[model samples]
Target: MSRLTERLHRMLHADDRLDREMAAEWEEAPAGKPASLPPEEVNPDTPAEQPDWWISVPFRQGRGLRRLLVVLSVLLCVGIITVLVITAQYLPHFGQAGNPANNEVSRRYIENGMEETGAVNIVAGMILDYRAFDTLGESNVLFTAVCAVMLLLRVSADKRRSAAYQLELETDDRMYEPKNDLILRSIARLLIPCILLLGMYIILNGHLSPGGGFSGGAVMGAGLILMLNAYGFRRMERFFTIRLFRAVTVCALSFYALSKAYSFFTGANHLPSVITPGTPGMIFSAGLIPYLNISVGLVVCCTIYSLYTLFRKGDL
Candidate 1:
């Protein structure tokens, strides 16, 4: 009975133990050897491949290292939980006056924002002027996301021309096509211009009013989407293609980065900057803020429209 039990155990665990032994034997064996030789016979001249010594040691010792790792991981989690509990005890009550968030930064931004950045919208001034790089990063992130989606979903021209691909496209079109619905086309004709105008207004008046680049861009993207839906890809492609998307996006990002770099360099060095805040309430006031807002809006608009087109039909 003992012998049978031992044999069953060996059979069940044969893979793990045999693989380890085989690996060890293979590592110690010479190149092109029929069988593993004594270590003394191993060639001194030939470079030996490194073996997984850590795993080999633990496995030979019967899961000791795995159990140890599990214990350590548990201990580490417990330690982290304990530390968090201790830290929480020291935190001030919610909404306390002494809270760290109630700082001078907010006060300064509110008090001297319009004079400093020439933006009537304090939030716009802070984000565009004071935290410009963060906004730039966000724009880059959106661009990156679109690029990733394109990589995954975009169909090549060669594939697009294939019979199988054309059939698939026909199927998709049949499912999603509006079939020249006069009502939708009429509504789109009336609404697209208004939506686009509203988006432009929001972008242009970002510094003077509530709207900014991100919001305006989203509105414009929606207009583009509506237009695409009303008309077909053939009509849309005549104006907006992948080439235009690439050019516009690159130019907007480059202009944004360069302008911000110049501003940062002049300001940091205490040198006179050519860009002035201008009269605060004017449309062209806030120096580079409006321009930056325009750049951001363009990027956001392009990104949104491109993503929609690519996701819907795998091209822009």
Candidate 2:
């Protein structure tokens, strides 16, 4: 019985060992290679290309390199975030406006007999005389703006048809009707010429009087606007057209530039005036101050009027 039991135990142990071996062998067995053409059938004359070393090299290297790249990318991103957090605290400091230098320069110019420029308006003095060069540039800006508006406003009938793929329709004729409000229209018609005259007077007298070109020109523009609003755009358009405004603007600017240049050669700071206004305050006090005012007035008035017309007409 003891021998039989011992034999049975040995048999059980051997069975367990065989089962383990079988399991291990199943796990370790290589997977079947993809079925390939038989070596004998792979014709050498048809070109047996060498295995690409370069292609395999990249794939082999990329596994380790991909891990390296990921680590570097994480480090770089962390560093950038840290730098940004540090920088954000001081960013608002730039928005703080604190500057004394600009005020000092303006103050000095004001105290230095800028009154000799014949501008009662200190701002005007800065505009028409001190930064006269800048004014010239500004006028050119106005000119450019006017030209752009004109181009935009002028829609050719054919272009309109092409855009809509239909016949062009005429705009509402009521938009051009003469103001039948006889009382207002008549009053505006009478008053407009007078206002225009006054504006011209102010502009021409800019060198002599406290008023300068800008104010005078603005006054003139107001008169023009009054006429347009009361009578309609057609009346104003007839008189103060885009072409007319352009010519006037160019001429006015040229006159200003030429006068300044002539003053340089003659060693005179101002134009030759028929009457010089004596001292701080007088009607004929400043020599060419009134005239300069007039020039500025006309330029400003005409430009504003032109822009207004273009805008109202849907040109720009």
lDDT of 2 by residue, 1-316 (tens): 9976875565445435544655566666665533332233234453222222222333333344667998999999999999999998766554445544435767756885345554455565566656667766776677687778777675444444342312212345544565657887889988999999988877765544556676778888898888877877656666776567767887887877776555444546455644333554555544444445555566788877877876665432
Q: Can you tell me which runs of candidate 2 are displaced by over 4 Å? A: 1-108, 118-121, 157-178, 201-211, 264-288, 314-316
Candidate 2 residue 145 Cα shift, in angstroms, is: 1.6
Number of the top candidate by lDDT? 1
lDDT of each: 0.86, 0.63
**Candidate 1, which segments miss by more than 4 Å at Cα?**
1-102, 173-176
- TM-scores of all candidate predictions against the true structure: 0.69, 0.53
Error of 2 at 8 (Å): 96
Compose the digit string of candidate 1's lDDT tens values, residues 1-316. Answer: 9976875575456447765766788877897886543343234363222121222333444455667988999999999999999999999899989899899988999999999999999889999998999999999999999999998889777667655566666677556755678999999999999999999999999999999999999999999999988998889899899999999899999999999999999999999999999999999899899999999999999999999998888888
- Which pairs clash in the backbone of model 1? none
